[model samples]
Target: MKRVLIPVAFLFALFAGSGSAAAAPPIPVEPTTETLDCPGFQVDAVYTGKAKWIDAPVASGTKKRLKLFTGVAAASTATLTGPAPTSKVISLSLNGSISWSIVLSPEFDIVITGTGRNLISDPQHGDYPGGLFLTVGKVSWSLNAPDYPNGGITGPGSVTDVCALLAP
Candidate 1:
């Protein structure tokens, strides 16, 4: 019995030293102020939400939806410095049926509602690398859109990377 216990203890020690049992680092705390930027637009807005981890086999998964305060979007981007035109969302939906997600890892889904020359039109569809950057406190994550022209938007006119405008 002593010999068996010794081996079991040794195995446990070995596994623990191997880093398999190591605790995951604490998730980054969300910041009070959030800023979202795109190639041709930028918005510094206040968000109300929290990010939490999701159960998974391996790797950490976080899902977060930050709803921008009403008028914050317009107030933040009041001055347009980028090449893209001054854009605003007449109506935005980032909760309920539609929500924006920023995953620290590689997979995430973010959705917003707005229409502009260089912004996400109605019913924007994307896979990964959706050209979205969401800043939560000090940590930030970039959500990729599908690899395609005009952010998978049909019809004419240049609609390239309009999703970035919706980040917050």
Candidate 2:
């Protein structure tokens, strides 16, 4: 009985300690800082657009905001990979005589347009937006699981502008 109990206790101790180590704490690790420098190329043609809409403010007694929509087209063969991602904003006029002035608040909002993919892309394609991203394309963009929560939440909170730019 003593001999059997000894082995059982040892086995229990080994597994009890191992379980804690296996369950790692959930802390986010920052991305690597190493930069990639790629040669630049001139674009022949380009097309892009952006739009944002906001509901009444979430908190108390805030003025209602507006939405933004802009588009552009460009035809060029620009290589789109480098140490850091590049981005640009295009502006569109409402073309109306409204008296209220609308401004884009620099807060982060998901860009839900194909022509303006600079905001997010498939992780496999090296265009994954870390905070929240949805796979608009039909390919594997990352080795790990893709993020899907932000896809459900929809609202333009801080953005107050719609713009676009395309050149040949």
Candidate 1, residue 155: lDDT: 35
**Which candidate gets the maximum TM-score versus the true structure?**
1
Q: Give the range of the ten consecutive residues with the poorest summed lDDT in model 2.
A: 1-10
Error of 2 at 121 (Å): 4.6
lDDT of 2 by residue, 1-168 (tens): 000001111111222222222124322222111211111322121212211222222333443433232222111111222221344323222111101122234432322222222222121124422221211212111112333433222233222111112211
What is the Cα-based TM-score of model 1?
0.25
Q: What tens digits encode model 1's per-residue C-alpha lDDT throughout 36-104?
A: 344334544332222222221332444344332110011111111223244444222221111123333
Segments in model 1 whose C-alpha atoms lie over 4 Å from true places: 1-31, 59-91, 96-147, 150-168
Off by over 4 Å in 2: 1-66, 81-111, 115-146, 149-168
Q: List all candidate RMSDs to the true structure.
A: 18.7, 23.4
Clashes of 1: 7
If scored against the real structure, what TM-score would every candidate get?
0.25, 0.19
